[model samples]
Target: MERRDIEIFLTLAEELHFGRTAERLGVSGARVSQTIKRLERRFGVALFRRNSRHVALTPVGAALRDDVKAGYERIQQGIDRAMAAGRGFSGELRIGFSSPLVGEIIMAAAEKFRTRHPDCAVRIREIHLSDAFSALRAGELDLQITELPVREPDLSYGAPLLRDQRMLAVPSRHPIARRASVTVEDLTQSPVLVPADAPGYLLDTLVPAQAPSGRPIARVPTLTSRQELLTLVSAGQGVAVVGSQAVRFHARADITYVPIEDLPPIEYGPVWPGGAQSSRMRSFITLVRGLRQNEDDVTRSHDHEPSD
Candidate 1:
């Protein structure tokens, strides 16, 4: 099958909606239907079972998807690498960040990157939790520093850029706010507000399905933005587990940020599509690593110094 054909099939299989598949691929619904029909006829079998309201893959289609997805991804990666190599690192490098702290770091890196490679433009944007991987997959972003545990098969990640303590955001008047620290078990006292329509693994990291004691924690999928999440917490709608940086980035009079007594620190890192890295991307990665190392060294030096 052609690359576009494979893309359409895989996208339709994943989306299970003709209109959505068409929208994602920048084609019309009729085109998507015709392509699927052509593929079915060429294969001499029904690849999909569709009706007025639903679309589903047949057993043969499922097997084909499982078999070809990895190979197709590799082919795409090779094409990307070849194209990037042919271009020789003179175009815009798009970077994305998921949080304010990451954004600050990316901004600093972009400045240094531009200074070093004046010919290459650096475009930075903020990525949200709800639609984390789509932008990267759609080629809208080259790299993003997002929370870890990115288990996507086609993406690659690097070492942690920032590690921050996990904290619970609660209303100032709430009983949990009086505590010095809290734990996953404490989440049971109130519904935990989480980012809506996020991946399960990410949501699990922020707020687990069950605490250590096997008690179920109630989750309220109401968060859409940082401000909205904080507003909800301040209004006593629900509590949320957030990174320590929120204390500085999202300070509010009505909310108190309490550190989680037992949860591991949240780690943010660079995630990029394809296994191969372009020259511009590799240079930016190196710069970011060097800056982070310098910061760590300074922090350690300060910690061991004698006071006057």
Candidate 2:
């Protein structure tokens, strides 16, 4: 039998109804009957028992279906692999990500993507807050899935994949550490940690220069990396406004991650160079979108438990 006939047979075998199968296969019920009759005559046996209200596969037909279904799946998988290879899905896809939690999230999605497009290999590169845009603009990264508020004219970002509540990272010795929850106004008493050389908007996002009340929130001299920024917070030098993810990945003995009761949550998603999107990039984006739909609750067990 032809491949199309095999497909129709498999579909019909699962559906087990002439009219329903015909509707699914986009053919007439008469045509389905004709195919079954021809196949039975060729094999000289009744493959199905049918009446007005029922359609059931006979013993021989059931055996044939069980054997063919596995083989059919293998055949389809082979064809899909070949098609994926030809569609540029069989190449290296370099991805850049920031923050350890986001990295874990993206890598989890990448694993699923590799299972779907086995030929495509994904290599994740860690991005620093100071170098998020520079790496993308330099062609060093095909895509960077990071925190948003992307203002670059040449960069495009996908929809927010996940949102995390804003948390205030403070030294265990800081005064606010005694509070149940902190607000943007409290940071005015201490210098907020900032990443050195990051864009002004990003700096503002991380540790705003002023609170909603327009009181200036002073900053410690910019730190070179996220690790350095957190280290300073741990050392009682300053507070750092960060995301809930910090509790999972950047937990430190000297720091407390208190939820900022009044600030907006941080949103993250994929960002790539404008008009430079590739088939591999598109496939990765699709996989991330799927992962976003079924996010698993992550364990937020940190040593320094601050009230949410």
Candidate 3:
């Protein structure tokens, strides 16, 4: 079968909705229907059972999907690999980072990338709190390891490389600091401190403007850097929420990190421009995804281990 036909079949099988499959592949619903009908005629079997409300893969379709998915991925990888080898894949990859923890992780992946594809040069730069997406848009960096809620329509982000449980950062002398753990509502006591230039959506993601209990979280002064925020917290200016990475990289004698009972884990991932998926970006993303997958596999293995 043709490559595009295979892609159309695989995508339709996964979505199971003609409209959605069409939207995803940038084709019309009628086009999707026609392609599927053609494939069925060629294969001499019904691949999908469909009606006015829903679509479903027949047994043959399921078997075909299972068989075709892996082989399709391998083919794409082979093409990318050959493209890389042909181009000598020796270009500079600029990486942007926000936190030291993300910096450590992305840079580690960069080191591994260097060892494997020694032709490529990796450049790491610290991106400011307000410049996260701006740098990527400007093409100053090829990819960036930043926090989630990267909802810009022009940018694309990969699966998270790391997820850190959130904690509240407060002065060592604060009342909340003395507690073993605090709920998200406790932000009323100190308010959410964030960079003034941080987009409202990002601010909401980190520490919502209002707690689940409907109490508004007071806003404090502008912040430029994490250290500055920590300084303010240390001086009892206000409490700020941070990821667990702070416990390792930003621990200070004057500040304490207390687990937030209800906040979701902070997700960190690699993001790049939507249309600029280069050889370097794809390869680095693959490496980062592999690392996350291996970690997940080990965690699952441990979870399933038989206990004595």
Candidate 4:
């Protein structure tokens, strides 16, 4: 069936009136009727039961309408992919970052990418970790930089751009900064600032709960962004937990990163839809993967030597 035929069906399904559908589509009512007739003939199914006063979808038509909507979405995506290829990085790339730390890396990469492909436009949005998967699935985001591996079946991800341990960000003079490593219990009674986009998997699954006294007191939920959390921690408002990458990004004298031995390692990577792939996406992934490798090598080199 022709695309216009499906469009006509969808418009009629929504309007439930031939005259309204024709007016909305900027076509004559007779043309609307003809399009619906053509669609029914092509599909060999009665799509709508129409009387002088009412128009309604049959059971078969209802099922077909649902499938047609999905089909139209797929067609639109295909057209988008084709247009993106034809323009060679001329369209806007909508990217989502899970936190400000990841945003920094993505912004840096975007700058470099734009220099090479100056025609391309980049728009970045800070999304909560909880909403990242949903946004991507809904086609609201083209790419996402988040902690991986993401659990959604409809999502796929490139290899990690950076992998680092979680650290406790405390005032430089905090007693915990003197330790080689810390446990969850070490944070008891310490006011902790948490980012709103902070992944629950990291906090709930990795960090242990309760002290030896069996009292849970390891969480504080006052801050929402990395900047806010770090600002508060720097001001001695409270301590906060962050990835090791935060140490590289911010080197304020008031805040220090303390290694946390018990927490799981965090992986930061690019995420995209499972079935969608494009040359631009592949190139972006390559750039991030190279950055991660370079960072890893530099980290390993530093681990073998003492600080000056």
Assess candidate 4 and give its lDDT: 0.73
Mark the regions of model 1 whose C-alpha exceeds 4 Å error after superposition: 1-88
lDDT of 3 by residue, 1-308 (tens): 89988888987886678886786566888999999999999999999999999899899998998799789869867886788888787878999988887787677789878986788899999986665678888879889988886888999876566778999998998888789999978988676688777777877888888888899899774788887898888988888888888999988999999999998988887788887578788788767655665676589689999999
Per-residue lDDT of model 4, residues 31-102, tens digit only: 999988887888798999999999999999988887887678577556645765676777777888875667
Instruction: Give the number of the best model, judged by TM-score.
Output: 3
Candidate 1, residue 92: the lDDT equals 91
C-alpha lDDT of residue 259 in model 3: 97
lDDT of 1 by residue, 5-80 (tens): 9999987886678986786566999989999999999999999999999999999998998798879868765664
Report residue 168 deviation for candidate 4 (angstroms): 0.8
* Tens digits of lDDT, candidate 2, 83-175: 677775777788998877778877887898788877778899998876778888998889998887777888987656667899899888776
- Is candidate 1 or 2 superior in TM-score? 1
* TM-score of candidate 3 relative to the true fold: 0.72
Quote the positional error of residue 31 for candidate 2 in Å.
Answer: 41
Where does candidate 3 clash, by residue pair?
Answer: none
TM-score of each: 0.70, 0.67, 0.72, 0.57
Candidate 2 — worst ten consecutive residues by lDDT sum? 294-303
Residue 103 miss distance in model 2 (angstroms): 0.5
Clashing pairs in 4: none
> In candidate 4, what residue range of length 10 has the lowest lDDT sum?
201-210
Candidate that beats the other on TM-score, 2 or 3, i.e. the better one: 3
lDDT-wise, the better of 1 and 2 is 1
